[model samples]
Target chain A: MEHPGEGTRNGGSFVVSCESVSFSYPGSGRPALSDVSFELRPGEYVGVVGPNGGGKSTLVRLLNGLLKPDSGRVLVSGRDPATEPFEVRKHLGILFQDPENGLVAPFVEDDVAFGLENLGVPRKEMRDRVAGAIRAVGLEGFERREPDTLSGGEKQRVALAGLLAVEPDILVLDEPTSMLDAAGRREVLAYLETLRAEKTVLHVTHHLEELVRSDRILVLNGGELVADKTPERFLSDADLLRENRLVLPVVQRLALEIGLSPARLRTPETLAEAILAKTESGTRAG
Target chain B: MRLELRDVRYVYAPGTPFEVEALRGVSLVVEPGEVLGIVGGTGSGKSTLVQHMNLLLTPTGGEVLVDGVDATTLKKSELRRRVGLVFQFPESALFAPTVEEDVAFAPRQLGLDEEEVQERVLESLRALEAGELAARSPFALSGGEKRRAAIAGVLAMKPEVLVLDEPTAGLDPATREDLLALILGLRNAGISVVLVSHDLDEVAEVADRVCALQEGRVRAIGTPAEVFYREPAQAPATVRVASLLRESKPEIGAPVRFAETLDALRALQGA
Candidate 1:
């Protein structure tokens, strides 16, 4: 297996691979992405994070053939995404932040079926796939509801259903829950956990808490892949996080203040449990 | 200015099949120079409620009062000038060829003289820390720069009450912190801020008071600790962690903000 931060040494069975990819927008003096490299194995839940102009979105566009890298190669399942656009799309699906951007139909059912219909799936199979997709997102009863009438969280789920119906092997989500509220964000994040076992997921987000469960976290800065580490390692390094302009979540920050390892006490439950254990032992010793 | 909504109600598409009650008897107030946070889930009428602050949407029932005067009686422009409404994605509303012209649009429409408009444009851009970007094209600026330039458009109006809808939606951690600091600084300068967002942690950090909405109705309105502590499921991460600790140690008091939570945890260690 290839090690983290060693993406230049390729030659592994990776579902997605980028070899020293560099891209720049037209008329722009600075490159949007510079010498970025990463690899994603199948069923890998990788989280991408950085500042506003840090090329997170540019990297996502490159993976789906929307933007061609100015130099180097981008391979999805061994096929170059820039040259074989259709082939790359067959194995990958992208879900942007605004669900409104992806929804094309008035009715939820029809919107979910749009991808399958475009692929020329038979009517009988399309119906089954649409139902299955809707069920996967827990929208089984809202098939006839209009997209405009749904809540922000519901609309996002419908968009995911649309992508799931296509049966793509890889799912790349770009801030899928940023527009959502606390409850809505919980809903989408919970659904993403269900996707971890079957799909190679690349989730880009500004919320560090969302990356806690990720298999690997990639930090991008000034269009460069600055750091590639697991969530625990990433959270434990205060300097690395600060260099990338990231701050720990409130719970993790509390752990740091209480002289506890922020990585192990990442979540509220675990932190609370650890605190209780420490206090109980202290009470006996004192 | 002190803004008050007494049992405000708004219905979309009234007298039609699509009619829906967006705000149902919502009542609140924005005291002068204080930061009030409005929090809710989707379809909870947070956006609709903020629209009433600037009179973008007239209440179907009940009165909106600005400093004890009925808001409806004031000229629309006068009311708009006093209560600037920064819509969600305010950057999308920046249409002028340059950032300077965009920030100047509101003041110019206020019938201010040319010199006054120019002064407000520069002052507002500086207030948002975007003075260097005044000559740049809005489309050419970075996402954070564009967001600040757009907010400058509203700031140029010199509204008494500034209502921002999800100001930090897509911003990264550092930029989000900067915006929050800017908001607090504005409140310090005597402008009442109505921060409407889904970001619970941010609300807890800056808000003097918190308001919660549910299904077009006011569910709770109090200090951040009062509202968030009462609803543990919806509390900010720090408050949630504190609540988790309280289950085992009931002596711990309610702590809403980060510093308060840290203090509470420190007290637990008896340090």
Candidate 2:
């Protein structure tokens, strides 16, 4: 599961690094990102969260060299993305907010093989890789189905399979499940959990609940890196979250409001258990 | 101000190889001054159902009635003005150079005088809290601001019934809260609203009643507590949590909102 380019950067620990990076869109009065710096270690799950227009998309684009920083530097595996764009892209697989934008080929299997074909993989190896990737995303029987015929969630899975076919080291997903329903969201998230052991995932989302399980969270606000901490520390600060235009998850907020510790009620199951425990203890005392 | 669909059915590309039935005998009613939330999975015909409200799409084998009058017999322009339909990602439809011009387009096209059109435009902008963005180009506004401006364009038409298709699809949390509040305000001001959304929590918060659509059919329709609590898989997180607790503690009620769920749990503990 080790990355081929692992030991080439920061003593083989950090896979991606941003040093005082700043960027502004053309004609924009304010910078989209300013003096933002962070580093991702190998196989670490980092969640990037902020409000709309909070420079999240900008940061993801910077990571893959799709958009170069206006100032400072961005490095992937000890190589600058601006200078070594091809090398950076070879190791990075980015899924954008809209799956339609990433899906180019008409058929599902062909789309998964597009990147492998670009890398000039042998025909036999490409077929095997495509089959494995599709199976990984649970889209095995949909090889010949047209991309347009798939549902929103299926289309996103197809896009993920396309990313996995290349076997990239770093996976950057920007709001990958934003357009999906509850079932679809769970489907995509379940697959992402399986990927945690092998790949470094940088998930950018507006849903604070989605970040509750991440190893670390990077909070952005008004083009600034406002907070960098574990998910527990980040979720505990209600005022900070509100100030950054984010709302606490419903369960967390309910726990905080009802004099219960939010940390103990991170999920709906736990929240239900806590309530039942309280009811039983209260009845026994009565 | 009431709108109803009578066994409405719509088929896309009828009699062709790619034909598909989007809506199948789906019927619902929106009472005056009430918020009717429509919940469904993807391709459940929520958008197709709303399009029939404004006469944008004619039902292949059914009738749309507004205040007991057959909508098909009504003038298309008049029906459009009376029933404003806001499509998904309406901001992407903004084409005018400036926000004011975009908002003013509908009122002017309705043959309102220049002064009246200006008044309507300003009023709609103020209604959505976007008056400050009047002169800015629609292209220049942020995602939230652009959404408000697009809604203002529809509000300028002064529709009696407003149908929104996934209005809060890509909005951030704070922006989403603001937009929900705006929808409530519109309902309080006597405008009936039909909200089609996938966010169950949002629907639970603002909807007076909710209808569930599955595979182009009406699956369930009732108050938020009744409809949301009926199916654990489709319920909001708060209701699902309540349902889970109810298995062990039967006294706890089905609470759809966070505040209500907390209060219900506290009451159970107190008793």
For this target, which candidate reaches the highest lDDT against the unseen true structure? 1
Name the regions of candidate 1 deviating beyond 4 angstroms. Answer: A1-14, A139-145, A149-151, B15-17
Which regions of candidate 2 fall more than 4 Å away from where they truly are?
Answer: A1-14, A84-86, A100-117, A122-155, B13-19
lDDT of 1 by residue, A1-286 (tens): 2354434324544489888999998867899999887888888899999898898988999998999999988988788889998878878999887676677796899999998887889999999999999997778888987776675567888998998899998999988887788877887788889888689999999999999999999988989998889998889988998988898888888889989998877677888888898899988889
Kindly list the per-residue Cα lDDT of model 2 for residues B96-187, writing each as its tens digit: 98999999998999888999999999999998889999998898676678899999999999999999987886678998999999999999
Q: Compared with the true structure, what per-residue lDDT tens digits does model 2 show for residues A219-278?
A: 888899888888888888888788888888788877777678885587778877887777
TM-score of each predicted structure versus truth = 0.93, 0.90
- CA lDDT of B16 in candidate 2? 68
TM-score of chain B of 2: 0.97
